[model samples]
Every structure is written in C-alpha cells, then in structure tokens.
Target: MAAFDELDPLSGRKVLVENNLTFHDVTEAVAAPIEIPNARWWGFFIVSVMMLGLLLVSLGWLFWEGVGIWGLNNPVDWGWAIVNFVFWVGIGHAGTLISAVLFLFRQKWRTSINRAAEAMTIFAVICALLFPTVHTGRPWFIYWPLPIPNQMGMWPNFRSPLLWDVFAVSTYFTVSLLFWYVGLIPDLATMRDRAKTTTRKIAYGIFSLGWRGSTRHWQHYEKAYLILAGLATPLVLSVHTIVSFDFAVSQLPGWHTTIFPPYFVAGAIFSGFGMVLTLLVPLRSWFKLENLVTIKHLENMAKIILVTGTMVGYAYGMEFFIAWYSGNPYEQFAFANRAFGDYWWAYWIMISCNVISPQLFWFKAIRRSPLLLFIISIFVNIGMWFERFVITVTSLHHDFLPSSWDYYSPTFWDMTTLIGSFGLFFTLFCLFVRFLPTIAMAEVKSVMPQADPHFGEDGHHE
Candidate 1:
C-alpha cells in the first residue's frame, strides 16, 4: 500500500492523523462515557431533569388555567408559544443540512459532528412540537388536527397551513430519526461486542439489530443510508419552507411576505449551527475530544454561520424594501413599527445577534477560539428567538386598525414554560450522550488516513 502525506489546502495544516489513532481508538473513545459515568454528567443530567419537571409543572398549570394565563389578547393572539415554536423549528434545520445535504455533496468534515447534530435536530423538533400542542389550549384534543374519524363529524381543514405543519414536522422527525439510527447500527454492534456485562451486551445487541458488519450487510447499509440521505436533503429545506408558509399564508401585513420561506430557512440553519456549536464546544472540552472535533471543524461551521447570517441580514433588508415597494400602507406600517415601534428593542436585538455578531467569524482568530465560537453561538440562539418573537408579536400587535393595537408581554407561566422547554431539550441530550455514541465512530474511522488503502505503512505513496 502507498502512504500519501498531504496538507489540508484550506488550513495549510498537515493531514496526518494526530496521535496515530486506530479504529479501536475511535470506538473506545466514543464508548467511554457509556461504560464510565462521571460526576459532571450526572450533575448536568440532574439539572436537565429539574428543568423538565418545571416544564411539566408549567404545562399542568397552563392546562388548568387555560390559554388565558399567557399574554395573548385581541391583537396579539399568538405570543411566546408560537415564537418558541418557530425558534425551535428553525433550530432543527441545521442537523439535516449537515448530515444529509453535506453528505450528498461528499463533504467529509461532517463525519465528526453529524451524529450529535442529528440528535439535536430530533430534540429541537420535540421542543417545537410542544408549543403548537400546548397552544391548542385543550392539548389532549390535539388529535382534532388529524384526519381521524369522529362521531361529531369534525374533519381537519386540509387547506390550513397549521394542518400542513402537522404533516411537515412529523415527517421531518421520522426521517431524521431513521437516518440517525441507521448510521448507528455498525457502531452499536461494536459497543455490543465490547460490552463486559450481559445486560449491556443484550441492550446494545437489541439496538444493533443483529448487525454482523459483513460485506453483504455493508452493501445494503450503504444503499439504505444513501436513499435516506436523498430523502432528507429536500426535507432540510421543505420543512422550514412549510413552517414559513404558516405565516405567509396569513393576511397579516408583516406575515404575508413571499420572502418568509427562504428567509426562515436561512435563519433556521443559522441558528441550528449556532446551537450545534453551543452544545459541541462544551461537550468536546468536557470529554477531551478536541483531537477528533478539532478547531478546523469549528471554523468551518463558523463560516457557515457567517454565510447564512449574511443571507438572513439581506432578507431583513429586503423585507423593508418590499414593504415600501408594494405601496401598501399596512405592510409599510408593520415593517416601520417592527423597527421603530413598541417592540423596537427586540428588532434591534435580532439584528445585533443574528446579523452583526456573526460577522466576527470573518476573523480567523475568532473562529479558531472555542470560547469565542461558543459565545457567538449563544448570541445566535438568542437572536433567532427574538427574531421569531419580533415576527409573531410585532406583526399581531399593530394591525390596520389603530384602535386594536395593544402591547403584549409574557406572563410568569410563559417564562417558565419557555425555560422548561430548554430543560426537556437538554434532558434528552444528556440521556443521548450517556447511552449512545455521541460521535459516529464508523464514519470518523472512515475519514481517518489509516483507512485509505492507498496509504502504505512505510509512509510512502504507491
């Protein structure tokens, strides 16, 4: 075999595998957390559980008190709940973008981070799903949106974008889950074989689905994975596009723009990457996975954030331009009020966080610093939340009629419920980190230079 040594053209860094890690090393590194539990992990898990409990309490109170507990009223009918929904949904877009979109483009860098990002996508969707369900007020009757037969003879309005959301989000979640699980089979088998205890072996074996890693098995696995990736690539765009439709289909001035689809999709990916960085930075540091999840990977993600951030900024500008160009007074007033009205602070916050902060990534130094990347990512998350808030609340607060305009604010329950959603997200994430391989071991190994047959042990090209 020939051993080829090359440099990474982008970073001018050596492509040699650091520490000469092997396939066994990759498996052991990923499986270590499952085998040995740590105090930090438990501490984080406990906190997440406590937060989840808070969500449960808040939800229970909301059910008992009704939707009146929130800051919803005449003009501002949809409040923090819808805002949170859109925010979480947008945050889910990055996972499929990295996993399916990049994979289709033959991007190798995704191997190290795709597993956790896909898990984050599923968790984010779960949080997003909570908002619409709870907002129904009588959440138990949420099945009303389904086409289930009923004695009362009530069928869901298929034309409504709200119903469209039910289909879009559910389909996105199912496809993402299947893709993630399919990728885990080989790694799960590795875990099963390495397990010392019968309980662990049995559990992993069941999840592994009798994976033997034979040549025939791999051929089928590759085909299935590729097919799923093809299916998921469109979902990365379509899911968010349909979500934007929930607003665009409305008669509201600010909500009715055609730009909402592409704009929302970009913002979703932007926020999704930010969240991925927020979760991964601390995770890699805590687990000492810097070698695997290197600065290069973080930098690449930062570049994406910068590009998408710019697109979001452009979309923001175009909305204002369109408002004026349309010669529609309601649209003009809505856009003006969004930037200079009662919720002006929120608009600027969204601008600063989503548009301005990511510009720092243009500097290689900033992108290379984990602490800076983490901080900027947090800003992106906060900014994206405010973006939804500004869109949902500001548009509703000021309608065409001056008499109906009213200020809206979240109630105590609203604040708690939002916090609780974070708890639910983290709780699931912590559990995932503990039980499953946080990194795709097989994929990571495949990208390693040692896996290349053309690379010889003598460190020379064939």
Candidate 2:
C-alpha cells in the first residue's frame, strides 16, 4: 500500500500502533517471546521463586508462632498486614478499568495493554487475598469467614466490614478471571494451531475450547465478551468502595470520613496504572515491543496517571478541609497530627511521590519518554504504598486515649512478608509472559489499517 500521512482536523495525529506492520507481523512479534526462550526470563523467574520461598517461610513461621510476630502495639492493633492488603487490592483496579471499562466505551488504545493488565489484576488479587487469611492468626480457621452449616450454630457475621471484603474481592477476582479467560480464547486458538510440541498443543487446545474462528464462533465470542464487560464495569467501582468502608465505617478520628469511597477509588486506579507502567516499560524493551505498544499508548496512560493523581491530591487537601470544617477537635487533631506529628515523614513521602511526581507528566517530553515514565511510575507505586501505610498506621498510632498511644514500627517479619507478596505477583506474571501471548494478537490485528475495508479506496493501495 502507498504511504498516507493524512490528518483529520478534528483529532490531529493518532497512531495506536507504529512501524507499518501487517497482520502476520503482529503475530510473529507477539509470538516471538513464547517461541524463543530468553535467559532474562529464566533469571527473572528464579528471583521470583526465591521471593515466593521467603513468603512461604514467613507464613510458616507466622502459623507456628502467631500474628504477634508482626509489629503490633497497644494502640495499633492492625499493622503492615492490613496495609499490604489494601495496597495490593488497589494495585489490581487498573486492569479491570483498562479492560472492562475502556472496552465498553470503545477505547481502541486499550487493545495493546489490556491483556497483560488483566493478568496483572489476577496476580495482584491473589497476593491481596493472602493477607486477610493470615492476619487472623489462624490459617486453619480462615474458612470460618464463609457460611458453612454446622451443629454449633456459628456463622460468619455479614455485618462485619472484613466479611464484606471477603465477598467483594472474591467476586472481583472471579469476574476478572472469567473476563480475562474469555478474551484469551481466540488468541489461545492461534497458539494452539501453531504449537509444534505435543505439550504445547494440548495446553493451548484445551484452553482454546475448540475455537475454529468461524462466523458463528466470532458471533458468540463477541456477545459473551460484551456481556462479561458489562458485568465487570460496575465491579471496578464497587470493589474499592467496599474496601474504603473498612476505614470509613470505623469510629476512629482519622478513619471516619465520607470522602473515602471516591478518594480510594481514584487512588486505586492511580496506583494500578502506575504498576502497569512499571511492568510494561521494561518488558516493552526486553521483548522489542516499542513499535507495537508505541509512544501513543504510553502517553495515554501517563495522561490518566496525571488526572487520577490530581484527584488523589485533591482528596488529601479535602480531608484536611473536612476535618477543620467539621469543628470536631478529634478530627482536626487527626489531620494535623498526620501532617506534622510523629509519622510526618511517611505523610510527606506520600504527598511528594503521589502528588508531586505525577505532575511532571503534564510535560509533553516526560509523558512520551518511556524511561522517565518508568521512574515516575516507580515513585507512584512507592507513594501509593506509603499512602496506605499512612491511612492505616497513622490513624491507629494515637487513638482517643493518649495513655494507650504509641508509635508503630514494622518488624523484620513484616518486611519479609511485604517483599514476598511482590514475589508471588511477579512469579505469576513471569509465567504468564512466558507461556501466553502478552499482547492480544487478534485484537491488535483488528486495529491495523489493512483490516479496514476502505484501505484501497482511491487506489491508495498497490
């Protein structure tokens, strides 16, 4: 086809994909990673397993001794475990937002990143679920949170916010898993048809569900995907809303606030997109995917980070405003103490990273620079974790009675457990990239110029 650099007055310039690639080129590019094993992948996978091992060891010791191994104090009953839980849960929000919410709205840019983002969502949620179970100090009794009929007449209290977490997160994970799986079927069929080995053939064939790419198959797939997308869009809002309830419903001075729902939701999408940048930038280089992912996709995500980060900063200021406006001494002290008191260091870190760093994305160069975007994204992840820590630890460090107040500090075990959760997340992600097509091959093809019926109009094509 002849080169066409035509521009529409309305949208300026747009390129969801670069490099003038055809359908076969997209397939070869995406399938290269799975077809040829890389040494870098093995190294990444090994380190992840080591981290997973540490998590296992930490949990084993926790089960043997108790939750007392954590740095819990008189005033601070909840510690890093709860903070990590919230952090991981927030890290999962962007996946569903990109895949389900954006898909429903017909955002074409999501085609490149949505598959990997969905996998990240599943892994992050798995890491999030671990903390609540272990935090109870009895892994064996973890099932007590479920309603099981028994002669003792004991059942989970549905009224508890923690129980609501159980329901909300599980439902989010289930719907996300199904949605991700459904999207993968067409691509899995591609992998199945190309598999050379019996093991690969069997694995891909089973997961592909005998997809033949016929007219009937495409019809069912589109209808099913649309239905699942509709089902998943509400969950993007509801899951985080329920999570915020864990703090908002509390009577504690710092924790009691009405702004928590929207604030937490915005922060979740903010942090989740941060993580997507952090993971995708390096892989984009390692896998030679810059053309496919393109500067446009990265910039769009950066724009989102800037927008949500601003909302989060607004919430921060709003919290202080609400405290002062409420005329409650306890609420005022909580806000003041968080900013200027004992845990002041953590609070400022959250502000500088979450609020300040994302502002740099407002610049055209920084938003388009993959390296700079990666750095800021790292800062976003750190700031978001600190945000959760501040929300959890600062509020509990000093309660109503000063006599029972104390400074909260994490133990070595706390450090290990937190790092190990990263291990689990990366381990699953490494496996995903190795075995499956990280980019959605079919979706990417659909967005190409050759897929358009008007490609040869005016004899533009050779």
Which window of 10 residues has the lowest lDDT sum in candidate 2? 1-10
Window of ten residues with lowest summed lDDT in model 1: 1-10
> TM-score of the candidate numbered 2?
0.96
Candidate 1 residue-wise lDDT, 1-462, digit = tens? 112334644345544234667788777777886788799999999999999999999999999989998889899999999899999988889999999999999888899899999999999999999999999989889899889999998899999998999999999999999999999999899889989999989999999999998989899899998899999988878899999999999999999989999999999999999999999999988887766787778889999999999999999999999999999888899999999999999999999999999999999889888999999999999999999999999999988788998999888999999999999999999999998889998888987776767665464533
* lDDT of prediction 1: 0.91
lDDT of 2 by residue, 1-462 (tens): 113333322345566667677788888889877888899999999999999999999999999999999999899999998899999999999999999899999998899999999999999999999999899987888888788997789988899887998999999999999999988999999999989999999999999999988988889888998888898889879999999999999999988899999999999999999999999999988998877787778889999999999999999999999999999999999999999999999999999999999999989888988999999999999999999999998899989899999998999999999999999999999999999999998988886666776665775543
Q: What is the lDDT of residue 425 in candidate 1?
A: 100
lDDT of 1 at 23: 80
Best model number under TM-score? 2
Best candidate, lDDT: 2
